[model samples]
Target: MTILDLPAAEAIRFAVPASRWDDAYAAGMSEAELLLYRSNLLGSDLTVTNFGGGNTSAKIMETDPLTGEAVPVLWVKGSGGDIGSMKLDGFATLYQDKLLGLEGHYAGDQDDDKMVGFLPHCTFNLNGRAASIDTPLHSLLPHRHIDHVHPDAIIALAASSNGEAVTREIWGDEIGWLPWKRPGFTLGIMIRDFARANPQAKGAMLAGHGIICWADTAKDCYEQTVRLISQAAEYLNTRLAGQPAFGGAAISPLTGRAAIASSLMPRLRGLMPNADNASRRKVGHFADDAETLEFVCSHDFSRLAALGTSCPDHFLRTKIAPLVLDPARLDDDTYLAQSLEDYRALYAAYYQRCKRANSPAMRDANPVVVLVPGVGRFTFAGDKATARIAGEFYLNAINVMRGAEAIGDYVALDEQEAFDIEYWLLEEAKLQRMPAPRPMVGRIALVTGGAGGIGAATAARMLREGACVMLADRDAAAVEEVRAGFARQFGKDVVRAVACDVTDEAQVSEAFAACSREFGGLDMLVANAGIASSAPIEQTTLELWNRNYDVLAQGYFLTAKHAWPLLKAMKEQGGTSVVFIGSKNAVAAAAGASAYASAKAAANHLARCLALEGAPEGIRVNVVNPDAVIRGSRIWDGDWRRERAASNGIDPGEELEAHYRNRSLLKRDVLPEDIAEAAYWLASDASAKSTGNMINVDAGNVQAFTR
Candidate 1:
C-alpha cells in the first residue's frame, strides 16, 4: 500500500479562534443551518483525505434560563448530502432527549414498538427525508461540536483484521476503538456508553467505519480529526518505507508533464464546457500540480488501481473517480463500453454481498472514474467545490493506500460491511426527506432490443432523464457497450447495460428482474427492442415471421404485462410515462417488407391498447414511429443493406440516398437524436395530457406514403 504521510506539525492542533467560533454560533444557526455547516466541513475534509466515508453533527439548544426551560435540538448530516455544498435544511433535526433515550435500548433487544416510540419527536425536513440513525449518538455526546471523518491513514489501518490492535498501539489510552455495528440506535448506544466510561479519551474509532471526535469549538473538532488521523497515517508510512518498489509500466521519460497537462486541456475544457476560458484556466492551474500528476501516473499498471474518490459521500458531487487512461486502449468508444460492463458486474457483486450481509442496496453501480491509459485523471463533480475536494482527497488516499500495502497486509472493509454503511438506516432516512417527488429516483427501467439504432437512441435518451436504464439485447455485450458510453458521457446514475435476448420471454423477464433488483424498483418500461427482416411475400419464411413477431409484438406484450403494476403505481403518484419505439414501416406499405411491416403494425396496435388500459390507472403510454435513422447503426451495414439495394437494382449508396433525400419531405436523413428527442418528449411532463398518441419522427419519408 502506498501510504500518504502528512507532516506531524499539522496533525496535533485542534483550536479555533473564539471569534470565528462566535461567528458560526451567531449565524442564526437553526438546526438546518447547523446541519449544512457540518456537512460542508465533512465534505471539504473528505475531499482532502482519501475515501473519507463518515458523518458530522451539531447540537442546537433552545433554552429559557429564567423560565426554567431547556430544549436540546440535534442537527445531524443526512445520508446523501455531499458535505461540500450541504445547504441549510439539508440536516435532519431531532429532539436531543428523545435520541439519548434510545441509548438505553440496545440493538439486540429493541423491538419495533420501542423503536417507534423512542424518538417520536424526531422528524427530518419534509423534503430531506429521514434523519441519520446516528442522530442518537450525536445527541448523547456532551460536546456541541462534533466531527466524524474516515481519514485515509486510519482506514489504511482499520480495514485490516488487526486494525483494533494497531489503533491501540498508536493512540494507546488517548483514543478508543469500537467494533463495527450496524449504525443506528445500536451504534449510538455503544458509543454513548464508551464515552461515559472513558471521559479522558479524545476520539473513538469504529472499526471498518471511521473516526469520531468532539470539542467545544468547531475548529477543535476539525483539527483533532485531521491531526489524529494524520498521525496514524504518518506512522503507517514510516513503517512501510523502502518496501514494495513502485516499478510497473514506466511512464515514458520523453513525455513531458507539461505536454501531458496540455493534452488534457481540451478534455478539461469539455468537462467544464459551460465555464469561460478564465475559469477553465483556473481549473487547469489546480489540475497541473505535482501531486495531481503523481497520483494520475500511479495507476498506469497497478492491479487494484485507485480511480480517484476519497469517500462514498463524494458521489453527491465528484462521483466515484476520474477518467483513467490506459495507453494500450485507444478507441474511446470501445474502451468505454467494455469498462462500463466491468463496472456494472463489480457493482452487482458488491450489492449481492452487501444484501447477504443484511445491508440495504445502493441505487446505481456506475463507476465515477474512467481509466484512460496515458491521459491524466479527469475528475467530475456536479459543481466546482465537489470536483476540487474530490481531486484533493483522491490524491492523498492513493498515496496512503500505496504506502500501507508496502508495509504489512492491507485489507479493505468487506463488501458487506461497506454496503451496510453505504445503505445504513440513517442514509435511507435521509433519502426519504427530499421534498421533490423523485419517487422513481432509484428505480430501474428496461429498454429491449436496445442495441438497435432506434432502441439504442431511446435507451440513451431515457438514461439522461434520470432513469437507471438497462439496455437488453441478443448482442448483450455490444449493447451494454453502447449503454456504457452513455453512462460515461452522462453520469453513472443515468444508465446500466444488461445482456438478454428480447425474443426469448425468459431472457427478457430475467433482464427486467435484474434491473429491478439492482435499482430497488421498476418504474418505467420502454419496449423499443425489435427486429426487422425485409423480404418479398414469396421469399418471407415462417422462421423470419416468428422471429420478427417474437420480438416486435410478443416482446412488447410481455414487457408491459410484467411492468404494468409498477407503472400504475408511479402514475398514480404522478409523473410516470412509457414510450414504445414503433416504426414508420407500420404505416407505410413498403414492398418486400411484409414481415417487418406486419410486426411493427401489430406492435403499434398493442401500444394503443396498452395506452387505453393504462390511462385509467394514470400510466401514460405513447408510441413514436421513425424512419431512415442509419448513421452510427449496423442497420446500414453489411449484407442486409446489400440485399435491400440488390432488390431495387440500385447502388447501395444511391439506394440509401433515395430513401433519405428523395423519399422524405425534409430531403434529409433521420438521425437517432431526432428519435431520441421524441422519446424524451413523450416521457416527460410536456406530454402528460397527451396519452394514447403516436408521434411520427420520420423526416418526410412518411409524407410520401401519407400523401
Candidate 2:
C-alpha cells in the first residue's frame, strides 16, 4: 500500500469548522461571514495553498442601506494577502458587473496590466487595497463561489505535457482544460468562455497555471477542491508506487564540510554582488533540507531542476531555471566562480529574448535558486526572508515536478508566457514597494566576542544597516542569549550565534566555517575578542602573559588567517573589509599593565600589516581604538568592576562611569556605539579609500591620538 491507499477521510485535514456549516447564511449567517470563515479554514491547510500563492472568493448580494436596493459584490482575495491568513480586509469587494463589463471595451490582446488599471474604478471601498488579478476571473465565472489554488498534487497533472489528455481521462466532461494563457484580462475571459462552452463542467485546470473549482456555496467549492486534488494525488501515487527510492554512491565530503562551506560561501557571495561596483550587493542563504538534498541527489535532478517552473506565477518568484551546480565540482572555487557567472549571463539573455517594448527595465539577472548537486540548494535574494520564501516555493516546485515526471512529463509554459508573468505590471508592483536598499543591504558580517557589550552592540548595528551577522563568542549560553535578543530585533534567521573561543584555533575555524555555511558568505570581519590583565613587569607570570597575548593578539591573527582566503575571493567582485578592535592602552601604556597594553599594541600592528597585504585584493583592514567605557559593559562586569574602581580610586558604579566620561575630550562616555560607528565606516563604501589607519573613537583621548 502507498499514500493513495490511505482512507479518504484520513488523507487531508479539512479544517472548516462544523459550526460554520451549521451557521450557513440561509441557515443563519450572511454570505460575507460564511465566505470569510470558509476562506480562513481553507487557508489553514498549507498543502492546498502556500503563502501568497492562491485566492478565494464569493459573489454576494447585500442591500444598499440607503437605497434599499441589492448590490452585487465580488469578495475576492486582494494582492499581497495570504489566503491562509485571509480576513475581511484581505478580500477586495468589487462591483461584479463593473469587472465583467471591462472585457467589452478591453481588447482580447490586452494583458493583465491594462485590465488591472481598471480595477480601482470598480472596487467598492476596498480600504485602499487593489483586487488580485484573479478577481476579474472569479467575477467572470458564473459560479457563486470560486477557489483558485496551486495544489502540488493537482498541478502534477495540470502541468504535465499530456495535461489535457490526463484531465479528460480523469474528469471527463466534469471539468474543462485551458492550456497556458497569460493571466489577466485575456486569461480571465478565456476561462469564462471555456466554462460557457463546457456548461456541464464543475471546474477547470488552467494548464501550466493551476486548478479552479466552483460551486453555489463556499463549502461545496472547497469540498470539490479537496475531492479533485485527492483524485489527482491518487492517480499520481499509483503511477509512482512501484518505483524504488533513489540511491547512489555516497557523495564524498569536499575537503572538510566546514572549510569548504567557509570558503565556498564567500566565493559565491562575492559573485552575487555586481563585479563592476562596490555597492550593487545581494546576499545568499544556504539551505539543505531533506527534500532539497533528496531531489538534488536523485538521478534526474539536473534535468528536472533545469526545466522551468511548473506554474506561470513561479517565474516571477524563482525566475527561469535555477542556476545549477555540478555536484562533482563542489570543491573548486574557480569552477564555482565561472558557473555563477554563466548563470547570470543566461538570465540576462533570457530576459532580453522575451522582453517586450513596454516591459519594465530588467532587474539584476540573478538566479533565485542555486542547485548544488548532492550538496543541496542555496537560495539568493537581497534579504533572508525572501530567500527562505523562495526556497519554500522551489522545494514545492521540485516535488510537483517529481510527481509530474512519474505521471508523464513535467512541463511549464513557454518562455513568452513565463516572461508575461515575470514582467506582469501587477507582479512588478509588488517588487517596487520594497524599501530602498541600505549601504550593506546584501552583505554578511562576522563579529567575535559577540556576547560582550561592545561586540553585541556592533552586531546589532550591522544588522540595522542590513548585513546578516554571525555572533561568535566563547560563552555558549551568553552568545545564545545575545543571539535571541538580536533575533527578536532582526529576524530569527538574520542573526545566529556560535560558541567559539577565538583563542582556540579549532574552535575559531569551525565558527567561521559555520558562518559561511549558514549565510553563504562573509564580507566584514570584526575581530573584537579580547581580555585585559594588569600586572607589573616583576609580577607578570608566564600564565598571565600567555592568556593575555593568546586572546588579545593571537586571536586576531587566527581569525585573519582563517578569513583571508574568503576575503581574497570576495575581492574579485566588490571590496571587502576587516576591523580589529584595539584599545587606548595599545598607544598609551598604563602602569602595571605591560601584558594587556603590549598585546593590544601587537594586534593593532597586525591590522596595519593586513592592510598592506590585502590592499591589492580590494580588502580593507583598519583598527578602532577606544578608551574606558564602563557603564553597561560586559568587559567591565562582575570582578572587573572592582578592579576598575580600585585602579581609578573611585566607587564601582556611578563613580566608575563618571571617571571615563570625564576622561574624554567630549566630556561624555566613550560608548561602544561610538566605536561601532567608526567600524561601520570602515565596513561601508564610505571608507572605501581609508585603510591601514587607526580610527580613534575614544571621545577625547588626546593621549591616543596620532603623534
Candidate 3:
C-alpha cells in the first residue's frame, strides 16, 4: 500500500519509503538483472539508504566459461559507487566458495588489511572491480540474496541505548541483535554464527551500525529490507508524536536567514586555517530546511553535537562533529576567527590522543560542517558536489539523532573507535586513489556579458578545469539558454545564471551576492560586457559616448568594486584575479571609432589603477586587448562591421575579414576562443604573479602591442 493509504494522522508523520517494485517488469529478468533491479529500487529512496552508504548482493549459479559446469558466484556492490545510480558493471563478481574459503587463512582482527588483499584472488573470470569492506558481510550470510543498508530510522534504533529492547518490542523474535564490533572477518563470522543459531530470524541489527537481512529470492530480500525500515519509522513516529524535538527551541530562527548565511559563509571560508600552501580551496553549500533549523536552534544542540555522529558515513563526510556558531555574534570577525582557531586546536588534540604508530598523518583540521544557530547549516568541501553531499549526510544524521532521543538516550560511537575508522588504512588508500585536483578546482568566477561568444567560451574553459561559474548578462533568456548548455556539458552543480546589467550599481551588487550565496565566494571577475560605436569624434553624440562609457568603463568599475571584499577575504587563499576585456582600439587609434576606443581606453586605465591598489592584498587585475575579432563577436553583428568595412573600402559581406587578415602582421583570423584563452590564463594561477599588463589577441598587430 502507498503511504497515503495509512490513517490520515499516521501518514502525516510517516517517514517510510513505499516499495516501487514492478512485478511485471521483473518477470523476464535473469537472476543477476533482478539483483540490480532490487538495488536500484532500494537505493532510489533516501529513506531506504543514503548515497554510497549501503551495499546489496546476490549469490547465483552461472556456467563456468572454461569448464561448462554451473558454479555459484557472489555479486556484491563494488567500492566507491552509489547503488541507485550504478549499472550492471558496478557489481564485483567472485567465486562464492573461494570467498568463503578465505576464512581458513584468516588469523584474527589484525589480518583485516590482509583479508582485503585476498579478495582479488577470489575474483570470478578476473573481473577487475574492487570489492568493498562489506563484501564479507553479504557473503557470510546463508541466504542467496542479502541487503545491508543504513536507513536513518534503522540507524536511530541501532544507535540508541535501549535499541535491543525496543527492537524486540517491535518485531519480537523475527529480528535479532548483535553487540558492536568493527566490520571485518571477525564481525562477519559473528553475524554468520548468529544467523546459523537463530533459524527463525529474518534479520538482525548490529549495535551502533545498521541492519542486515536476507531471503532466498531477490524480491523477498528487497521487500524484507523495506519492511524493517518502515516498521522502525512507524514505531519512532509513535514515540515522538508529542515529544519536543531536541528539548524545544533555544533560539528563534532569524528573519532573512538566507541573507545572513550568504554574508557569513565567505568570511567563514576565509577564516578556516589551511593545512598547507597547496591545500585545495573549499566551496560551500547552505541548508535551511525545517529539520536543520530545528536541530541548530534546539536547547540540546551543543550537548548532542559535542557527542558527534554515530554513523561512520556521516562522520567521515562531516567530520567528528560540526563547529557551532553563536547566532548573536555571527557578524563578529574576531569571534569567528577565534572559534575556528579553537576548533583546529581541539581537532589536533583528538588526533594526538588517539593516533597509533601506523596511523595516516593528521589531515586538514578545518571543520567540513558548520552550524549557525537560528540560520541553518553550511557544509564546505573541495568541490560543489561533495559540499552538497556532505550537507545531505548531516541532515540524515540529524534525523537519526531526533529518533534516537525520542526512543532513549542517543549514543555515539566511542571516540577511539571513531578515530580508528577515520584514519583507517583502507579509507586513506581510497582518498589517495582519487584523481589529482583540477587546476581550477574550488575556484568560483563571474563573467559579465556571459551569453556572448567570448564569455561563454571562457566559462566553458574554467568549468572544464573544475570552477563554478556565474553567468551575468543583460539578456536574461539568452544567458539562461547558454547556462543550460553548460549545465548539460558540465554538471548543473557548477554553473548558475543571473540576469544583470553590469552598468547598474544595485544589479552588480546583487550579482556578486548571488555568486556568494550560490558557491560561497568569488575568486575571479571577468569584466567583459561592452557596447561598440563606430563614429568619428564629430559624428559621436553625447548619448553614444555615455552609453559606451556606461558599459565599457563604469561597468568594469562596478563589477570590480563589488568583487573587492570577497577578493580581499580570499587573498590568503590565493589566485584572486580580475580580467578586463579591453579593445585593441584602446591602445592603437582606429579610424571612425572614437567613442568605443576612448571608453575602452578608460577601462584599460582602470585595470592598472586596480592592480596597483590590490597588489598589497594579492589581488591581480589585467587586461586582454582583442582586435578585429569579427567572427562570433556580438559587436560585429551591427553597423560597426559595415562602418569599419566602408572606412577600409571593402565589402561588409565577406571582404572585410580578408582585408583585416591581410593587414595583420601574422595574417591570422582571431576567433572568440583566442580571446578566451588569454582571459583564462589571467584568471588562473598561471598568471598569478603577472598583473597590470595587457595581452593583445590581434593576430600580430604591432600597433596594439604593449609599449
Task: TM-score for candidate 3, please give it.
Answer: 0.96
lDDT by residue for model 3 over 284-376, one digit each (tens)? 999898888878777778899898899888888988989998887988999999999999999999999999999999998999899987889
lDDT of 2: 0.77
Give me candidate 2's TM-score against the actual structure: 0.88
User: How many pairs of residues collide in each model?
Assistant: 42, 1, 0
lDDT (Cα atoms) of all candidates against the true structure: 0.59, 0.77, 0.89
Off by over 4 Å in 2: 1-45, 60-70, 85-89, 142-144, 168-174, 196-201, 215-227, 245-260, 273-278
Poorly placed runs, candidate 3 (over 4 Å): 1-14, 276-279
Worst 10 residues of 3 by lDDT: 1-10
* Candidate numbers sorted by lDDT from highest down: 3, 2, 1
Best model number under TM-score: 3
lDDT score, residue 203, model 1?
A: 77
